[model samples]
Target: MNATGRQTDLIEDYVAALTAALHGPARVKARMIEEIRDGLADTAAAHTGEGMPYHRAAHQAVQEFGTVEELVPSCQQELTIAQARHTARAVALTAPFLIACWYLAQAADHGHAWLLPRTAQLLAVHLTGVATVAALLAAATLAATGALARRMPTPHRLPLVVAWAGTTASAAMAVTTLAFATVSALTTNWPLLAFAGTLAAASHAAVAASARACRRCSRLPTT
Candidate 1:
């Protein structure tokens, strides 16, 4: 049964204290609280079925749930890895955009006019292959890091840092390449070049935001 009567107050107080001791995303915190309440309520229901009164069942349930102190460390660690996994997934999704944007910028600048008929087709093909490799490496790195975050008992600290570093580096490369394209466009008055640069700028912005989130997750204690 759901929390009812005195059980509600007791569960609320316990969850509040548990939340105060834990640090993570709000969603995870709320989920943990919900799960605890559900378990406690079930326990209380079982006690009441044994002929215990409502108030006594609630207290008994709380007692049986054990001390929150011992649960806090594990909860915090779980939240940390989950957060890292989230960032890794984000990196996987966006890193390809960084690759594509950088490739586009380079091709447009090298070939002129944002890959028009007059653009150098041979050079464009070569840049495409290079960008594909970078994108693949980035994807693999993030995927591995994401898996590590999900299951490893300890933080894959070095690998996680490397993955994020690679992500940021890829974005930085895109920005630098796009800057050149932007300059080339301004000099030649190529409107499509500006669009390529704009996309690269957007990818760079996303990487910057992800970097901040990564830094926060890195601070979590994994031991």
Candidate 2:
């Protein structure tokens, strides 16, 4: 092979190793890997400018770029931040839809005069409040991860905090929604039960998904 081919092979091998060592959301990881590749290419080109052979320059660049072990921690930190952002955004967007579903269900129930019981009313209120809190926490997390991140210290802990807050809020909302659905099914007519139960199930599923994502983020190793 020509010197250029050998140089490309060496660089590709190093990048493959780096890719294997890291994990995260695909788009974020891919962008990071591309940036790394660009840096390596620039360094290699600089070495070649000083009269080194192409392959030798590539090898030197790879060596100077550091091992996967040394780089993985920083890369993982970025990936974790992306994941936290995704989880927070999911919660923020989904919460409002779920709240609207519950509202519609409540409205329908009220029209039937079936919402007379205080306990049912309380459960509906509790679920709505919990979902609202979760959405607000999610919004705060987005801000923390965005503009506030530049000003904040120990940014690694932010993801953990995001995970914990999201999980708790999602879990509370899911459980409360389940209870509300159970109450609706027992106390209302078949049509009302079907409507409420369907909405509740969708809401439960959405909250559970957010909770799972947050749980995974929480488990990520801190830098």
Candidate 3:
């Protein structure tokens, strides 16, 4: 194939790969690809010094633009936000199941004692409330991630710092939760409480990190 044909093929492949990697809304993928293509075209124009044929210029431009692997990290800052959204969806889906488990554990512990029925009921109600909150949080995180993905064009250092801080917080929360869960499981203490707390903390941290990463990505200049 000629240089133009080769460049076209490269662009086509790049778009397809981006679509698969992003796995979010079609509009997002389309917009991202369009930006990348424009960037490549501009870079080629600069490289050629004169306006060469589209194919040759484009091919040279793309070749200079580097491979997909190099580009993905820059793109992945936005993708992190998309991942956060997916994570939120997972959290929402898991909420009811977690509540059900909480109830079942309560029942098993209580046996048929018929005592503390009110307490059991209250616990179940509380679990439901927690689940509802989790669902809401998940939805909010997803929406925020989507919005961040749209607005930020390049990676910024400040956002990355914030994201790292969030990740550290999340790691700390996870460790604490794991410790609590271990204690609760071994001693039959507050397993449900520990588990719920851990999950919520971790989810929040993940969302924060994702958002920060997206913001940082927006600051990076495209080639």
Candidate 4:
């Protein structure tokens, strides 16, 4: 085969091997592939300029990138962290919906009259309002966190940490409110309490799972 054909075959072989080894998010795989492709191309050109055949330069480039067997473990670890971060973000996004579910359960039990008591209704109203504000602020911060997947896992800082805190606090408060309401309704509206309690439990469970995942993701080097 010609020099150009040989070089193309080498590049294709290298890329195919790398791709087979990468079991990460599609975006990560694509990004890494592009980077490696350009890097190999550059390295090969440099070797060719130094009196090497194109195919020989390409061979050198492939060897330089390490074998697929060598790359898989490291790539898998990196992508696991990325997957964790992605999961945490998805959980956070569900917070508002979960919070709403809690309210709907309560409304179903008490009709509109359940919230008629000034103290009880006002308290839930205020807490939910706080949760809303916190959730909104947290969203802005959390959006930037996905960027971390491109780099390495580091201890979460700045907006991500703060955003997570806000979300955690909101979920806790919502659950607390649900608990109190459930307890008050235990005697007269036990059936309603059952319904409301179920939804609250679901919310709490989701929050717990999300928090745990985020904590794991936040710790630097989760490998």
Please rank every candidate by lDDT, starting with the best: 2, 1, 4, 3
TM-score per candidate, chains pooled: 0.65, 0.77, 0.42, 0.52
Residue-level lDDT of model 2, residues 1-223, one tens digit each, is 8778888989998899888877666788899999999999999999989999888999999889887788877788777788778777867876775567566666666656654467666766776786788789789888888898889853656667667666765665566556556666666454655565565566556556655665565565646
The parts of candidate 4 lying over 4 Å away from their true place are: 112-223
| Weakest 10 consecutive residues of candidate 4 by summed lDDT | 214-223
- Tens-place lDDT per residue, model 1, 1-223, is 5546556788768878887777555687689878988898899889899999877898888888877776676676666655555555555565565556545556545644543433434434543454455456556555655565467534357435633664554455464555546465555645655666566566556555555655665565544
Q: Pairing residues by index, what is the TM-score of model 2?
A: 0.77
Name the best candidate (by lDDT). Answer: 2
Please tell me which model should have the higher TM-score, number 3 or number 4: 4
Task: State the lDDT at 193 in candidate 1.
Answer: 56
Decide which is better by lDDT, 1 or 3: 1
lDDT values for all models: 0.60, 0.73, 0.54, 0.60
- lDDT agreement of model 4 with the native: 0.60
**Model 1 reaches what TM-score against the true structure?**
0.65
Worst 10 residues of 1 by lDDT: 115-124
Q: Model 3 Cα displacement at 87 (Å)?
A: 5.6
